[model samples]
Target: MSRERRKHVVYITKNSEYHCRDRECVAVRDRRSGEWLREHSALRGRLIGAVTAQGRLLRRMRIVVGMRLCLEGAGDEQLVMTSVVRNVGRPKKSATCAYAYQSWAGVIGA
Candidate 1:
């Protein structure tokens, strides 16, 4: 029998960890069998939008590490930011910031 995929609502905590209502966040393990079930995946540069409580799209937004989001379909086919009324906290610096600085340094032969 094939198992069906279910949608999930997740949020990033202040420490930059993914939390879910279903207790299926990344790096979670089953108490019975100590097997790794999930791992981090690349989601950079993906287009996401804020959603209202009534499932309405508010506006397009970027996926930050501290935002609450809902995955609507399998393989993250649709990612919608949820709970716009709650405070998501400030986003951290982009990972590319260091890379951009290094690139500029190389160009200047510094």
Candidate 2:
């Protein structure tokens, strides 16, 4: 049996509405398509951290609560709708990805 792959949907306020930092995971939004792109150090950071069993659980990430996420990889993945938020939290233990979401905002919660 195979476990179902999990899909993450993130809400991003247009830069006009709320400034974003993409704090949860580094992300970028397309100018025309409105697609958010996401990566967590090529998904390796979590795996490396997992080896120690101290941290690096993806789902437990508090930033994920209302993250500013973009679909990972290619294809038809998309967010349902964008929501407004005041602030987003940065993870205490995780290192920022190389891209580091400088191109866009971070997280999606107030």
Candidate 3:
């Protein structure tokens, strides 16, 4: 038996800086793509804290919410702009995988 993967589509904001120290620096992500879209912060800092603390669980974090992401998969694709994280809750007790989406994933790796 095999398990299915998950995927999500998001429009990442352009030319933005994410700061954790100053709340005033906070701002909702804006979609700069030609596609009309609503902005959402997909990943949160709480999740980062958990990942940082659990070094034994993952050797390195290739992805983090709020990070500027570019697709590295096979074939030439333009930089897929999207927000890394929307929100993060308290850590779960039984998380095994290094990458995860808490609430929803639109596709299983499209």
Q: Model 1 over residues 1-109: C-alpha lDDT tens digits?
A: 6642432333433323333323222222222453322333312213244444455553445334333454442365545333332333222234224323443555311
Q: Count the backbone clashes (under 3 Å) in each candidate.
A: 0, 10, 10
Go through the candidates in order and give each one's C-alpha lDDT.
0.34, 0.29, 0.28
Could you report the Cα RMSD, in angstroms, for every candidate shown? 15.3, 14.9, 13.9
User: How much is the lDDT of residue 56 in candidate 3?
Assistant: 29
Measured on C-alpha atoms, candidate 3 has an lDDT of 0.28
In model 1, where is the ten-residue run with the lowest total lDDT?
A: 21-30
The TM-score measured for candidate 1 stands at 0.29
lDDT by residue (1-110, candidate 2, tens digit) is: 68424333222344412122332223434435644334422221121111112333234333332343222222233322233322434322222332344333444210
> TM-scores for all candidates?
0.29, 0.19, 0.21
